[model samples]
Target: MGEFLRMRRSQLQLADVGLRDFGERRRVPGLRRDELAQLAGVGLSYYTRLEQGLSLNASAEVLDALARALDLDEVERAHLHDLARASRRTGTRRRPAPERAGETTKQLLAAFGDAPAIVLGRRSDVLAWTRTGHALFAGHLDPHIPDQPDQRPNTARLVFLDAHTRDLYVEDWPKKARDVVGKLRLAAGQHPDDPRLAALIGELTMKSPEFASMWSEHRVRKWDLATYRMHHPVVGRMQLNLQTLNVPQEEGQRIVVVTAEAGTGSAAALRLLAQAGTSSGAGSARQAARTARRP
Candidate 1:
């Protein structure tokens, strides 16, 4: 919680908070700790303790005041509350990783033969993907990425590290990256004790400097539907609307479907990809059946 507070504070500038720069040289980025405390209407000592992790019983009113001072959005405000809750129970027992996508969810993906669809686990691991799904998103990479549970290509990982995915996003790469980190922030708050989640964050933070910088922004987002533009190698420039469906039976698992507008060029491109996926042969069906077996 303290680290998060510090990071959020560092992201603000004097101008952003309506403060004047006296043209004085400053050592720290963004607002200083005392400046934030003053703006938040809290005692300097109290706010200091809060940031130092020495105080953990802040009231809702105080948090709201600090949140306002920080100019946090709705999702960021909720994430702050979650962090406060976790801070209160600092010594709780760690929980296991959340459950994977259920058979029903995989079946749902399989049923979407015309549209590209995929099931994503809590840590953004690609649990399973349909035939058109693989061709649309990760066809350039290893086709068997979703086959191995232990080594499945995590969506977050690919977004940051894969060259092919970088080319796919082209101009809007940063937006996609921010969305990934924001969703992961919500996931991290919900599953604070999951070692796998912890490992994934740590690995990305260490390996990708871009991920590290974005993670420090402390942004949080809850996504339902988002439109994305892609520059596919084969299909050319196109746009698709992404719809996310949560699996009620499986915790932290969601199915994402990519669809284009009817009678549009984007839709034609999607159809082309689906048609090409048909040539993947009997092996595609076998892979779908194997993925369905994973409860």
Candidate 2:
């Protein structure tokens, strides 16, 4: 809770909170402890203890005040509450069990014929993908990565680690990267004891400076309807709308579908890609099980 609060506080500027500067030299970024305390209507000593991790048990009203003072959005507000609740717990956090998509989820992916869709397990693992889904998104990589549990392709991993994926989202790569980090932040809060998730974060933090910087910002976002401009090596440039739907029966599983406007150039490109996959026998639902090196 303390770390998250501190990071968020640093993200704001004095001007952002409608405070006038006295031209005094200050050391820290954003609001200092005293400024934050005044804004949130709390004592300086009390806010200092909270930020220093010496205090917990913040009441709902106090939390609300802090949330307002920090200008936290809905997702961020929820994350703050979750962190506070977690801090008051006494027992050790348990490890999260591995998760995978079930038969019904696979069937749902299959039903999405021309639409590119994939089932994402907990930690953003590629549990399963429709034929077009494989062709559209990850066809450039070793296709076998999604088939084996141990070597499954995690979207978060690919976003930061794969050169091909980075190229695909060339124009808006940073936005995509930020979204991935935000989603991971929420996932981490929800599953604090997941070792694999922790390992993934640690790896990215070490391997990618961009990931490390964004991670420290403590951003949180809910993955839902999002649009992106993609530069596919095969299909060229196009805009696609992505919608993420949660699998209610399974915990931490979501189906992401990507589509374009019906009559746009992007839609035509998608149709061409789908047709090519079909002509090469790569569009069959059964073919998703077989691995094919991208040509």
Clashes of each: 0, 0
Q: What are the per-residue Cα lDDT tens digits for candidate 2 across 1-295?
A: 8999998899889999999999999899888988989999999999889888889889878988999999999899888888887777787667777777788888888889978999997799998887678877888755566778888988888999999899989998999999999999988887777889989999999999999999998999897998999987666778999999999889889999999999997887676667536445544322432222224
Position 175, candidate 2: lDDT: 91
Q: Where's the lowest-lDDT run of ten residues in candidate 1?
A: 281-290
Please list all clashing residue pairs in model 2, or write none if there are none.
none
**Model 1 ranges with Cα > 4 A deviation:** 18-27, 140-147, 278-295
Estimate every model's Cα lDDT from 0 to 1.
0.84, 0.84
**lDDT (Cα, tens digit) per residue for candidate 1, span 202-289:** 9999999999999988788889898889987666677889899998868888999999999987887777777555445334443543
